[model samples]
Target: MGNNRQTLLLSDSGYDCENKTGEQMLEEAKKNLQSMAFFGLTEYQNYTQKLFLKIFSKNFKLAEEFAQSNRTFAETFINKQNDTVQIPYLEEIKRLNKLDIELYSFAKELFFKRLKDFRIV
Candidate 1:
């Protein structure tokens, strides 16, 4: 008898699609970020940090009181999938104010996504 087998489609997770890494999911997100000029090395990091804070702060309003608002930041937060740990990158987002920090990481992703869309990178 001839062997007949069906192969499964694998997602980015590399296991049939479910293990989206932090960087992966973020890149595939919305595309509405802006571009700012940078000349110094640290300036790049600083820009990402500031933009990131704007993104999350919009999502988590409670943290808004803790950090300066991003003028061109998006006006929405992403719905959670399963509530995995998201505080580590978010916590240090702004300045350890906890709330702002979370927003920072998220907003930063948005910034990158936007940049990617406009081919800013």
Candidate 2:
């Protein structure tokens, strides 16, 4: 997505990305943990497992294990960081939560489609 679009999404999630620090991002992500369950357990579990596996191939099982250990696995998965690549997993999830249900459903569909394109699920 373009930077402007991303910024708008962040705004929808109540995150002022232009001014927020890394700590603020992490804090917001933590606060969003409870709300993440709205995704439903089974769907969250499947998505987490598949996404993690797709992103971190050899570490797929690690993701599964982490899910087992963390009851808020979906939130935790969403908060995962890749410092080297600078991927903002948490922020993405936060934006997702802010979207209307129809938009969110479309986003999920795109997500699953990408996974399928990659043969990850």
Judging by lDDT against the true structure, name the best candidate. 2
Off by over 4 Å in 1: 1-42, 45-96
What C-alpha lDDT do the candidate models reach, one value each?
Answer: 0.36, 0.48
TM-scores for the candidates: 0.25, 0.34
Q: Roughly what TM-score does model 2 have, to 2 decimal places?
A: 0.34
Candidate maximizing TM-score: 2
Candidate 2 per-residue C-alpha lDDT over 28-95 given as tens digits, one digit per residue, 9 for 90 to 100? 44344323422222455666565656666664366234443435665565457455443575456455
